[model samples]
Target chain A: MERNNDVWVFIEQHNGKASDVSFELLSKGRKLAETLSGSLKSVVIGHNIESLAKETFRFGAVEAYTIDDQSLANYRTMPYSRIVNQLVDAHKPGIFLFGATIVGRDLAPRAASHSKSGLTADCTDLQISDVKYLRVDYKNLLLQIRPAFGGNIIATIISPDVQTQMATVREGVMRLEPLEKPGIGKITKIPYLPEAFDSIVEIIEQHRQENKVNLKSAPIIVAGGYGVGTKENFRFVEELAHAIGGEVAGSRAAVDAGFVTPDRQVGQTGVTVRPKLYIAVGISGAIQHRAGMQESNKIIAINSDADAPIFGVAHYGVVGDASQILPLFINVFKQKLK
Target chain B: MAINSIVMVKQVPDTANISGQVMKEDGTVNRALLPAIFNHEDRVALELALQVQDTYSGKVTVITMGPPRASDVLRECLYMGADEAYLISDRKFAGADTLATSYVLSEAIRKIGRYDIIFSGRQAIDGDTAQVGPQTAEKLHIPQVTYTEEVLHIQDGKIRIKRKIEGGYEIVESGMPVLVTVLKDAVSPRPYKARRVMTYKNAKTLMELEKLVEGNSLLYIDQLKDEYLSKNLYIRTFTMDDLMLEAERCGVAGSPTKVHKVESVVLGGGQREMFHATKAGIGELIDKLMVDHIFG
Candidate 1:
């Protein structure tokens, strides 16, 4: 398997709209393409997705390889994977990337396995590097960096033995680049025969989850952790958030303790939030937790442990019990409003 | 109709006690120094398997690849209601990454005979690759549903599953002989029954029995293993030879991805101002926060 000489991104779309992650990958893939002195391409597979293929070019793709058909209107495991694997086999790329969404997670593995390639999932970062290890010179290896061992440590991985290095980066991990210009690249429609629509998954029903918590764009968040102690004590966190007109979130520990619902968890396994102001109550900032909220505009940590890791990322730190300090903070806000 | 189901489990070092010494310079963990326990997600996966058994008539078989001491998690699985457990242990299987481990597990799964469904945790806490379950399903050439939050139903030879995506979940239906990698919050595992624990406490794998025989010259390994098997206390064990796996594909040799480097990350904000528990300190903090427009 020789080098394919290009970086490719899978432009994920549903109902004729492209996912934000696909655009982010295109932006990141553009950087890899520059480093490798190669072209950047986008792989689009869906019915009536020509608009998305054109949109990829605006995001920096030099080409879009698309497979359009009525069977691709709704995502099914068998057909989507077969088509992606077919493209990879036909036009081998130096690098391939997918969003770590449900669809991508379901499709990428089967495609990679079909090609006998290695794939790193849920990656946080990607880079190109040249290094020497074990007497092997890894020239321009894709640095697939991810949090491992339950988010206590970060590990960098590379597929030295295989071609077409693949990775599925989690959504929102990388910032999306603005469009350089629109429709600068070409769209090459790959042929898809009707027989390729064979699948075992029956589409019983598909709809968006209504009333989903919009944690990504929350203006402010009041989050609690293990130090909050009990389910009843979490109300202190909610009261402060309510008084400040913000949403409530919790650390993995708090969520595991049943103090809050899984939807309200603020960590790597949960949501990645960058609220305007993030108030972390009694949260000892594990890297997993920090990875989710470290990008907030202003951070204030309230914890009794003076050396807690959360303080390391806080714009302001309060060295006292949250239960005692939250009441005081709420009262002060009440007075200020009056 | 009854179906045969297998659950893949792992024993991981308790990373909550992770320290500088726990991680070797080569990026591999020093498992001897740290306390080992059942991987949390794998435990939840077993619970899901048991629940499937309770709903549909079936027997749950739990298998794991680790050192001989890993039999602890196996017996615990029995105490929690696994029908049978296997210890897939060998020195050659040490330091196995996801690829090697999945290879060995898939081979043993083939030897274990028929199974309608296979369950595993989405990712082990130690490696965090989330690769083995999917990789195994691929090797076995079966469909897999990962990040599974719940098993909706199983009827007419098809199973419905609700799986977690980025922001929400989607319900999917898969035909028979599918694999599912479960999430930690999928289900709360039932507590070990006191009676089952008392009955299975002396359960031992063949390796454990060999060790016991080594210390006592009067006892023979075969005799003891047979005795335990008759008493329903012997755990099925498999080595590399038992699974007929190539030596090259059993451990580190089969792993393609290498850890380039390991760095201990310590968070730093450059400065942290500490406030006393007094009212004056609280008032000053409020003023600073308000000035920064963090609070209005």
Candidate 2:
């Protein structure tokens, strides 16, 4: 079963439920399978994943491969990578996908190196197309599109010579559509034999702090970027959000510059927010930042540079200093709200 | 417990501040036109390694694989209190994807010999793959901990680490010979020391010394290398011959993935409307937003 035109997605699950990105990949994998005239399959590896396997059918997966074991309940580097590598070796898939989260980054590369497959990390887009390399024509090469050079450029990667082409996509980039009528759900169970090496690293303890900043559900979001300049200047962006009853968010640059926390970042690496109203202040709307908030109902951009990229996507763009424009806008907004 | 640790480092271009003339006409970034600097996350990783050495009686050795010019970052590593440094350079190792990069690095690490803990930045800025540390671990047949935020405890070849998960963090423990990829927020990296800088500024690799010898006949590369090595100023340099690497698996040939095409970013937005910066214009915009029921 090596090199089947099938598209496979690694269903990452914790506890008993699968993550959102896995379902999103399933939805997109179906489209890629159709483009190749093949089938979409999902691989769920975790304990008590029987229900999770059934859930993949609603996301258009024709088949689900399950490997459930108590020892494999939580994600351990050795066990997970070994089992996934064995599966990849056994089933020669043409394309494989994983969510570009912490788990995926840790596991995908091990599989890639073990299987000697071509794998691209943090891909934002995936497509199937024919290509020519070294004067040889290749059919149905998986085009892995991703941001590179610190998100300065987009690169399309291909593995014309490898049996399986794989890519890890960031969460929230793909659309998750549940089928009205679920697909033909079929689950194939694989046995897990615990190896001595599986217990090398132990999870001695864990703590979960639910992110207090839930920007996705916010109705209105006021976001800032590196252009906000400093932590003090960023207050203007927040003041406007406060005046308008909007949530506070920022770009990755803002997070890196210590203007905002990483949880409040509105970009590809962060949450994908489609708030009703998105006010972007002092942001250039790089493709990475824009990827997360582009779906907002209304996008208003305020920046000093009139030709800034944020203006391109903004429904209403104000060319001025955010420090000045934000105060005036907040004053007027408060007066109107009163 | 005395430990031997290795920190993988990289020199990346300042991708943010690069203005015009950085991108070539073909839509690819001209790295030569951009300013190259030590990657911040790797600096943090180096700092973590140094802290580990401070707590436990250990020496931290840093290594980076790049062109001859990459020695600059190695010198910076020495300035940051690294006990030793290694520069992996070879023309054949150019154009490596993460897979190939990890393969070559795994081989190079084996040559470097004997490390209890291998530390690296979670991912480099330019590639942002975050794959090398774990992939190299896999190649080395070792367990890995990625997205590590901090090292809670390290003693007697056992380490307790706090790593970031989806919405939370987990504390994991592993014995020696484990690979831990550090997050940027792990620790604030210390600044370079003036005394170390003064001493290591002339630190050069054998390749660099050869170039100096070529430019001036008075300088002999072997004598220069001997002098530096005697003074402990030689940054351990390795070529393809130094490591047991398959040429087919070292660089472009070893890379399974290829860049089909590169495109300049053009994130075009759906709508385009401009409002004046004037106070009256701001008021009009606020009124419009209120009518839309978003501002109010």
Candidate 3:
């Protein structure tokens, strides 16, 4: 089968549910498909994930290609990559997009490599350009735009020779299209046989702690930095997070200080988050750090230094020690909730 | 059985100190003014891989893709205890993002033939994309443990690793030939050994040797390569032909994505007003925030 016109998005999911970043990518894919006059297709790889295809269509995919093999039940790189590669090879798309999530990060590159295609990662922006044919001049052209250099510059890239363009976009930078009405999409299931390849690695088990928020999908986040003083001060930030019904995050500094594990870190070195409400406590906001969380819908910064760089990107600024202000804010929230 | 590990490293432009004149108007970074350094986290990754090799009594190979200047990092890798180093450099490999990069690295790995493990930093400091390691593992069809904080144990070809999850951590176990993307805190890269540094400092790639021969007719390029290879000082250089990579799939023609534009955004600070901790004032502040869409 020759597949040439559709745009494919890797729909990332966990625990039998869709990741928000998948929705974000689908939204972006919808716009791109519209620009290219093509259909938006999503590829989902998981075990017993047939029900999730409808949600993908609602998010903007016209069809969802699901690989529900038992080998793909877990988030291991090998099976996921093989499945995605098989789909891409079988159904050649003009463009492929993935959310730069942990799974997407692990899967997209491998698929691109296997396909021998180009991929741009962590793209904050994406757009398709049109070619104006001039009869007198006899000319045609194409254009692509994306942000570059720590978000310092925007670069327009064009490929005059290839049939497909692939990129992994960070989540929350794009908006998902609203589900207007229920739409039915076809799901084609593919078998995954682990024995097909000489399996070098096997996933033994998976675990998650109770009461921990998945920062990638959290709606509200309260993050602390080195300026939070010590490990104890991080608890103050946590108190505010709990009062706000949000998750606790930290900067690379906080992680380096042993205030939190590297997983909760929000920065270029950590996780990229786009929560609805991001409260940065004592974060000075280096560009590397802001690159991860600057996409949050609303950002409030609390720090002792008025000139802290975080205030530049913050929607609101509180000039006070986070140690004192966090507890006060938590108490205020508690009183208001009552 | 010892773990045979391969580490993917990159020599990136020191973008932290990039100045106005350091970048061309066309958006390409000027390599001259910007000192090329071993990517910080990749060094940390190399350290972790070396520690594993030391603990398991295996061999560690370091690989990088860049211009001839990339050999600097490869030699550093050898000095840091890498058993062998390969420099995958070609003019055709320029302008590659993480996606293209992982493809080239995977191809090189296939050429190197055998490996039980792979290690890379979470992301390169220059791009900060954190996509290459996982992408390479995906290409190689290997299971990957990303954001690894520590390797708990390796028993019976099953490697147990403590990886950082969203809020906490998960102990994941994968079998042999796993790709482990490490964090900075995983391990501090050991200092360069004086003997290894002195031994590999004379290491040269084919291009470098050609330039040396041009400067001195008495120095034969072939002889230099042989001597360096015998002394384990030569960076194994591979071309597209060497790796059996298709020309169309190896460079710009194989790359479909194009860079669109480059601009720097100078985010300015916002205005602020202080309020006393009065109950009424705090309520008013909350109301103002709600009005401004900051809170509801």
State each model's CA lDDT, in order.
0.84, 0.87, 0.75
Q: Where does the lowest 10-residue lDDT sum fall in candidate 3 chain A?
A: A132-141
After superposition on all CA atoms, how large is the RMSD of candidate 3?
Answer: 5.2
Cand. 3 TM to true fold: 0.78
Cα shift from native, residue A291, model 2 (Å): 2.3
lDDT of 1 at A14: 77
- Reference contacts preserved by each model: 0.54, 0.90, 0.52
Q: Kindly report the docking quality category of candidate 3.
A: acceptable
lDDT-based ranking, best first?
2, 1, 3
lDDT of 3 by residue, A76-162 (tens): 666677667777787778788888776777677677767756666766567765432222221112244554553345565654344
Clashes of 1: 0
The true-versus-predicted C-alpha distance at residue A164 of model 1, in Å, is 2.5
* Best of the candidates, TM-score: 2
> Candidate 2, B178: how far from true, in Å?
0.9
The better candidate by DockQ, 1 or 2, is 2
Question: Recovered native contacts in candidate 3, as a fraction?
Answer: 0.52
Candidates 1 and 3: which is better by TM-score?
Answer: 1
TM-score (0 to 1) for chain B of model 3: 0.86
